[model samples]
Target: MDTRDLARIDLNLLLSLQVLLEEGSVSRAADRLNITQPAMSKTLLRLRDVFADPLFTRSGRGIQPTPRANELRGELQELLGGIDRLVKGEAFSPADYDGEITLALSEYIGVALLPPLIQRLHDLAPRLSIRTITRIENQLEQLAQGNLDFAIQIAQTTYPPAYRWQTLGSSPPAILVREGHPLTEGEVSWDRLASYPLIRLYISDLDHLEIARSSEAFIRARSPQQGSLETSHLLTALEVLRSTDYFLPGPAYLVRNEQATRGIAALPVPEGASYELQYRLVAHERTAHSALHNWLWEQILDTLRGLRVRTIHRG
Candidate 1:
């Protein structure tokens, strides 16, 4: 039925039905709802007519809901709860939100960020479930279509204004190699790096990702297909970096976690090869006035704000 059909429904009747279901006695239901028993009986008749089911049947001593009422019991409570929220508007506490949000980000960032992010959110909004996916066909488009709630991506130069974003931090280049690799022993340069293979960051859905390194400086290739080994899992990438001579190119802080990278090391980008990236928290403009969306965005921004990505100056 159209929403316009809802105008015919007296919302009070649903409340009465709920009370009746809970009380199981007409007199008790009426007393609980502050109405006369006859009035309550009449309301129950109206509800019956509306639902086309004798919502309750006489049991041995009292009353019991029919199969239809039994079904509507759960659905009706949900419907009434929605109505309550709608009437109350956006004044809500995070602890009250029982919704889920899907976030997209490269696993490289997720490794360093997700633990704290999830912990903070769970502390503040225990009822909120955050689901993360590492690969997506397109980040912004997914936010626009409501398929994704938020994304932590390498910043781009400009957005169409239909999207909202926050610059989380810088993501300067970090070349990851196993502890015993030759690059770790000698001066690490792009020329010396050429001897061993590079492990490219693989987010298979994106053909290329353009990263806005900084306000004035720009880098040509952010998502260049540069490596022989392409894997999206951070742990897997770290394992490969531990076992092989191949190097992984990524945000510096990703490999800086000592516990996670016991046998891996971060090399500053060579002077001539330096490029930078900034992490941006992106959401669609559709969520502009959504208190919940904004609240979650703020939580995310707070969770990932202080990454001090180091940079090397080039002549």
Candidate 2:
């Protein structure tokens, strides 16, 4: 049979045919379908004309399905099953979604930012699982190959042609220090900041160079013993600063969250010494519009907007 001819077939007839084949009697089939016996008999007549087969033959008490009907039964059931799945959406429940969705995020962003969103996802979809990989490594390739669903990163000057991005929010970088740090007592001048050992939370390779370029005057004034300590991970840098005199420069919004303990305080980075970091949600252009993918995209934006509004209200 021509495949296109199959496309013209009425799907409701196929369902009725399946019911008749299973029941082996028009009255029984009508009972199963909640239709009148005469209506089911008319449907069976139509099915016979469409397939040019006497699908069932009268026996003593019940009808017996013809060989052709028996042969088509399994195939019809399979086709209907596929259609049901397609219409109902994926079998992923929020609580039992076992399929893995990989995301690319910096250690700092993941630690300081993603906790609440993760909790919300768990509450909404108990089974949906998430795996976060480092954002700075092979991000475009990972996204292109379908290994990653989305990425959260500080916006940069350029991105690969294959990917697209949406800005979440932007915030001025602030100095994070211990509560009783000497700089917090009064105005923190370049010389005063230079005296303390700086702990750098470096997310990308370019951050180090950018900080040096922006803070050249302070770097020149600091003594050799007051050099900076570098860590590839943001959370580690924050933990280090919490214990010792080391200072960290990071986004003020991230530090304002519940993660920041009473022991730490955010201070303004003095004039000409501040940097702007933009939070961005990124994904491959190809899959950006998919239902689940777009849902996640909006969630990130909503969360960022709520946080920004709350900050404004507090100030």
Candidate 3:
């Protein structure tokens, strides 16, 4: 129905009429709906006025439906059934899902997370097309525009009303170095770490937002940003760490147990460095009710938890 027509009509009257039609007794309908007799009588009056018909009549036992009320029974049941189906969508199956899903995350985070995550997607949703974007400059704006379904990045301290986010986990960055590096031999201190040139893994999206107790912020406070190399790709930065005395500071938990990180070791940031980041999975309000979006969201969350658990067990 149109908005103006709907505004004048009370949907509850239709439901009350449905119950009254089924029970054929005002008192019985009131009892079923847990309402007082007078309340039920008032509802009947409203229903009559809305439908412009004396829908019921007094019978010797209880009541009898007028012809109009009898006329409404079959259509009312069918309409209500249709509405029920409309509210509850069909059962979701990943195999049936062939929709495209776009996820925005850094390449480093994807390196360790994507393998197991994609494997699950391959097994479950073979027909689905997936695209991952890296070096995201403005994830929030992208989320608002429906360009990205979800973003895995350093969690912000606050978000504006148009967004929704969930914390994936804490992100304490690790100083990744080649195996048998001098830092691996002994305790890592600010001065000891400062002695080596650093590799900055820039998250292009986070540059606009201010993060509290951020790993990069803490390092800037302690030492000069002495980067021998700064790059977007983790593979390239890790290759640099493998060759020279440069140290790469980035997401350690993601690559800790990965086969690609075999020759690399993730050492803790020096003591008193307030570099703990809360990684958030951010999405727009538009996708809040979407079946495919919610399913993929759960899969990403579950896959991340599984990754962390395996890291713990291996440690």
- Model 2, range 19-133, lDDT digits (tens) per residue? 8878778888899999999998888888898889998899986788899999999999999889998887665345555566788877766765577678777777667778887
Candidate 2 regions exceeding 4 Å error are 1-65, 80-96, 205-223, 232-235, 313-315
Give per-residue CA lDDT, model 3, range 1-315, as digits (tens).
599877987877888889998898999999998999999999999988888999999998788999999999999999877877788976778998888899988887788689899999999899998899987777898999999999988777678898888888876777789988998988987788877787777775565444534555435633565556768887888778788788876766746645677689888877775466667789999999988889899999899889888878988
- The per-model lDDT (C-alpha) reads 0.77, 0.75, 0.82
lDDT of 3 at 18: 91
Model 1 residue 67 lDDT score: 95
In terms of lDDT, the best-performing candidate is 3
- At residue 60, what lDDT does model 3 achieve? 88
Q: In model 3, state the lDDT of residue 259.
A: 66
As a TM-score, model 2 comes out at: 0.67
Candidate 2 at residue 304, lDDT? 67
What are the root-mean-square deviations of the candidates from the true structure over C-alphas?
9.2, 7.2, 6.3
The predicted structure with the larger lDDT, 1 or 2, is 1
Give the Å error, residue 214, model 1: 13
| TM-score to native of every candidate shown | 0.66, 0.67, 0.66
Candidate 2 at residue 6, lDDT?
83
